[model samples]
Target: MPTRWELDKASIYSTKAGEKDRTYLDSAFCLTDDVSTPSRHEGRQVAIGKKVLQTLLTQLAGQGSALSRERTALVVATSWSDESYFVTGVSGKTDAPAGFTPGEQVAELAAAFALGGPALSVDTACSSFPYALDMAQALVNSGQADNAIVMALNTVLPPALFLGFS
Candidate 1:
């Protein structure tokens, strides 16, 4: 049987930097990545989520810590009804008629990471992040995984969001 990890809600927000856990105070928004790098995904296909997921994995990877590919889980919090218009002008984009569910989206992103842990996606509107945290916590607590990486993201901001700011 796998080890039952005692996880904290803020575990992903902090990292082990020496003897103590360092809490991150820096906040980032409106980030963009130049997709010039090769993807680690199997088949090395230049997919939509591969590059972004790789960029986000930097902090957890290469640390040589207890968290292994098999022990860590992945949870993505996004609206099920997120932007569907970005299908055009982008590669690896899937439209609504296709497998356009949040679960499938996260599953693809999870595949890019090549991790063997449990992976899932949650859509709870504004409460998504919190809901995702709960689901991630449950995954660890239930011995499904040792740890989890929670990403609250959207494919693209819908027009309604911009209109609200206007």
Candidate 2:
């Protein structure tokens, strides 16, 4: 028999000005600077993803410091994966900068949240979120973790892609 899984809490941060909450999904037409940082390795997508993860984790951990515990897992899904889109296109660099891969982003989040469980990043374009959620569900159902944090991030930081499409 499969075990039952439940979502205790959720958070979302988008490029849109009014779509910070999931309830206002329709307000994500125009992209905005929801998560902008000056860090070299961190881009808009990573920043937003980190914010969402932190919010959800903080809610789950409460005031007792559940984040320090190792009973939770993190699964992130994104199309561009990391800051490669910006690094390669805008900077015209031939190599990816440090902490630009999907796996590295996961590691950074794990370290920041002090998560000790398994961390994975999935990239399947438009279907990445669903795939990540499925993976997280399996982890919980298999008794690998008591809770799982699933995140989906997408951003068009570099103007090349947007300009090209336009």
Best by TM-score: 2
Candidate 1 has its poorest 10 consecutive residues by lDDT at 37-46
Residue 63 shift from truth in candidate 2, angstroms: 8.9
TM-score of each model, paired residue for residue: 0.59, 0.63
Off by over 4 Å in 2: 1-36, 39-42, 61-68, 84-99, 157-166
Please provide, for model 2 over 1-166, each residue's C-alpha lDDT reduced to its tens digit, 9 standing for 90 to 100. Answer: 0111112223322344443332222434644453354333435456767777778767766866565448788888877756643454444344535446788778777777777778899889779999999999999899888878888766543333333333
lDDT against the true structure, per candidate, is 0.58, 0.64
Best by lDDT: 2
- In candidate 2, where is summed lDDT lowest over 10 consecutive residues? 1-10
- Model 2 Cα shift for residue 23 (angstroms): 27
lDDT of 1 at 166: 35
Candidate 1 per-residue lDDT, tens place, 1-166, comes to: 0111123425423333332343343444754434563222211222445655676677556564435777788988876332332332233534323334566667767776776788888888779999999999999999999889888776454333433433
